[model samples]
Target: MIRTATPDDVPLIHAMVRDLAEYEKALDEARATEEQLREALFGERPAAFGHIAQDDDSGEVVGFALWFLNFSTWRGVHGIYLEDLYVRPEARGGGHGKALLRELARICVERGYERLEWSVLDWNEPSINFYKSLGALPQDEWTVYRLTDGALAGLGAAVE
Candidate 1:
């Protein structure tokens, strides 16, 4: 079963995030703390939302998806930017990942959104294949860029 996550699931979310980072070989870069997650996910104006997949028989969480809304100026519609989607290794082949994504897609369709999107590491062939099988196309024409930590601070200072 898949359901919206509650504040009580913060620890589970954080742990899964760490697990995802490790799987992507970037565990050292995962800096999310439980307090930060709580604030971001359940703050006055929540920045993101989370959903968890549970084993019906055992009532154990098997997967999770974190996402946020983004505006597509060109499309003139809101889109869901999935930040993380992880299914425990033991839960592979159980359709949990696809079910999570299907739920997000349903949300977009029901809300009249333009698209559902997310990024995957270039090296994650398994995930890439899965997405392709689902008819998700990569935007090879676009490149993603980021500025964080010191670089972000530098940019802020430059603006002043």
Candidate 2:
């Protein structure tokens, strides 16, 4: 079963996020606290939204997808930016990830989103193949950039 996540699912989401981080060999950077997730997802003003998939018989959460909306100037329509998709190791071949992605696609269609996008690590060949099979092509023309720590702080100072 796939459904919208609630505040009560924060712990489960946190655990799964850490699991995903570990799987990707980035556990050291995964530090999402329950309070942070709750406030970001369930506060008066939600910063993002998420959906969780559970095993119907066992009632255990097997996967989740988190996303946010973005505006595409070129397309002149909104798009969904999938931030995370994680399925338990034991549940990989069970179609949970596909189901979650399809669900998000449906939401995108219903909302008239211009596109759905997510990034996959270059080394994750399995995921790259899966996405290719789903007709998703990587946008190699654009490069992603980030500002962190002192760089992020320096941005404000530069404007002044």
Candidate 2 local lDDT, 1-160, one digit each (tens): 8999998898999999899899899999888898998898999899889999998789899999988898899999999999999999888878888889999999989989979999998899988998898899999898888897799888967963
The whole-model lDDT of each prediction reads 0.95, 0.90
Per-model TM against the reference: 0.97, 0.94
Q: Which runs of model 1 end up more than 4 angstroms from their true locations? A: none
Displacement of the residue 25 alpha carbon in candidate 2, Å: 1.9
Best-fitting candidate, scored by lDDT: 1
Clashing pairs in 1: none
Residue 34 C-alpha lDDT in model 2: 86
Model 2 scores what on Cα lDDT? 0.90
